[model samples]
Target: MLMAKLMNLVSKMPINPLIGAAGVSAVPMAARVANKVGLESNPHNFLLMHAMGPNVAGVIGSAVAAGVMIKYLG
Candidate 1:
């Protein structure tokens, strides 16, 4: 979350830092939580769509990491 906020400060995109929290293995849940938090801060700030990108990316990253671990350990 902090990294996201920091990047946001330097980046040109208007990305909600809360969406950073959505980059977790629990895909939908993380996105939903980000959306909920965003809504809490501003009712009009619906972050679900923004969060989903990172959420899905996280899942894919986790799968790739798991695959690498299995290849090395199995």
Candidate 2:
């Protein structure tokens, strides 16, 4: 939810700033989300690893999107 909003807000910015913001923001956010899920889930469920997969993917996807956006916008 918040990530979506952040993306939307950053989309209006210039290419370089968008790429930098999204790239830097993703790392700590992914870590925070993974830790939160780990603490909330059952000990045996191993949800942290599962959650991190998508989180990292999202980060990568956003980075790719930023790159694509730069190709056209820059």
Report backbone clashes per prediction: 0, 0
TM-score of 1: 0.87
TM-score, per-candidate, Cα-based: 0.87, 0.45
After best superposition, candidate 1 residue 56: deviation in angstroms? 0.5
Q: Which residue segments of model 1 deviate by more than 4 Å?
A: none
Per-residue lDDT tens digits of candidate 2, residues 1-74?
45556667768752221223323336657545555555566455344444545556677888899999999999
- Candidate 2, pairs of clashing residues: none
lDDT of 2: 0.54
Per-residue error (Å), model 2, residue 20: 24
lDDT values of the candidates? 0.88, 0.54
